[model samples]
Target: MKKIIISVLLLGLIGGASAYYYAFVYMKNRKFDMVNAEAASVDASVLVKAYQENETSANASYLDKVLLISGTVSATDQTQMGERTLTLSSEDPFSGVMVTLDSAEAAAVNVNDQVKVKGFCKGYLSDVVVTNAIIVK
Candidate 1:
């Protein structure tokens, strides 16, 4: 009957609104934890080990913080953006940080030496930075 149709429509609107309300609430509460987790120290060997272990805390620990990671350097073409900034990276299809190096030191870093860097977690798709990397060896 007409009465039955009207009731169903009303119930659908209420249910949809309720779903949206809960989703909003959940996001608000989870944001703090997701963004404030401590940055974990990362090493390639340790990362491999953590990935193998069951329920490792590595990912959560570094969720949204800066981390210093050490790895081999890959040389990139030196470029500049405007006069003040360096054009280090073009756009990426995936998520990660786009980084620029201090122009004076960019040349010393070749494609083979081991280097260390500090960067923050912008998000999963964002990149980690290597703030002020120097050639250690």
Candidate 2:
């Protein structure tokens, strides 16, 4: 009985350690540097138009991909969590490309600013969403 209990405890400890290492060490280090990544250069209006015309085709071209988008800022807001966001204007007044800016680039932009941003496309839901974005100079 004692041997069995000891073996079970040891196995449980090993499993817990493996899970911790995979969650913290491996996954934490696996984040890609978005600034240095290869991305498709696009205009904000053009991207919105593509999604508006055909979401399926647009997803094939842009979903989960990094994009460098250029446009005039239509709005800027800070979320409750203090993350800065920018909305870039498209041809359609009702819809725009929404970018969640990285902490480093958040302080340097404003509405009407013609800026370029790089981010990963997170698909569209009324507005096209881009996350982990940084302003491109």
Candidate 3:
């Protein structure tokens, strides 16, 4: 009886440790390749317009989905943490598609440049937000 109890406790400890390592260590180190990911292609202006017209419908289609957006770069910004973001122009001057680039290579993009970016849509808040983006063109 004593041996059986000790064996069960040891198995439980091993199982717990394996679960923790897989969740934290393995998953954290895994990188998502956005460039190669399957994505819905869209124009930045159209994406913004869809969100502006009907947020619920837009969310149903775009929210949390990978998107490949093409547009003219209206602005670029670098956060204090060295994170780079760019805004794509839309028909509505007040709103645009905001994209957070995944790599430093995207920093080379300049305003007014026509470019393509792929990212995960994070829904709208005035601007359509896209995260983990990579400049495609």
Candidate 4:
């Protein structure tokens, strides 16, 4: 009886893993986005609002790849060693949305350069991000 119970439990575990994998990773991978480095520049405000409605919507405009955005370096995270992260927020005449970067990318920007960054639309992160981010740029 104990051996039979263990077999049933093992079967259940395997089935659950298979279902979860297909539902999350497999489906999401079909439309997963990558960044592009070459494209015409766009006004930053137009982006923040579009994402407010849908993340995948901009995939058509930006080639489903990375995008180049222009904004200001509003905040940053200092590092004792290596790179420190910087937060870039929209400088568009209409909004104040924020985006994050790894320490190294963040370091290349400043508080008020009106900088242009090339990264992807990674979705929303609540207070940290209204609807846009350049995760790898």
Number of the top candidate by TM-score?
Answer: 3
lDDT (C-alpha) at residue 118 in model 2: 97
lDDT of 1 by residue, 1-137 (tens): 99999999999999998888788876667533212334455653343334234323645655345555555444444435421111122123232222344333433555544554444433222333333222223
Error of 4 at 25 (Å): 24
Per-residue lDDT tens digits for candidate 2, residues 48-128, read 999999999999999999999999999999778888999999999999999998776744897899999999999998889
lDDT on C-alpha atoms for all candidate structures: 0.42, 0.93, 0.93, 0.53
Model 2 bad stretches (over 4 Å): 1-23
Superposed model 3: Cα runs more than 4 Å off:
1-11, 104-107
lDDT of 4 at 52: 52
TM-score of 1: 0.35
Model 4 agreement with the true structure over 32-128: per-residue lDDT tens digits: 2324445455545656656655756654655334556665666655545644444555534334445444433433555765666555554544322
Candidate 4 positional error at 84, Å: 3.5
Candidate 3: TM-score? 0.86
Candidate 1 Cα errors over 4 Å, as ranges: 1-39, 44-59, 77-107, 126-137
* Model 3 lDDT per residue over 1-137, tens place: 99999999999999999999999998999898776899999999999999999999999999999999999999999756788999999999999999988864544888999999999999999899998999885
Weakest lDDT window of 10 consecutive positions for candidate 3: 100-109
Candidates 3 and 4 compared: the better one by lDDT is 3
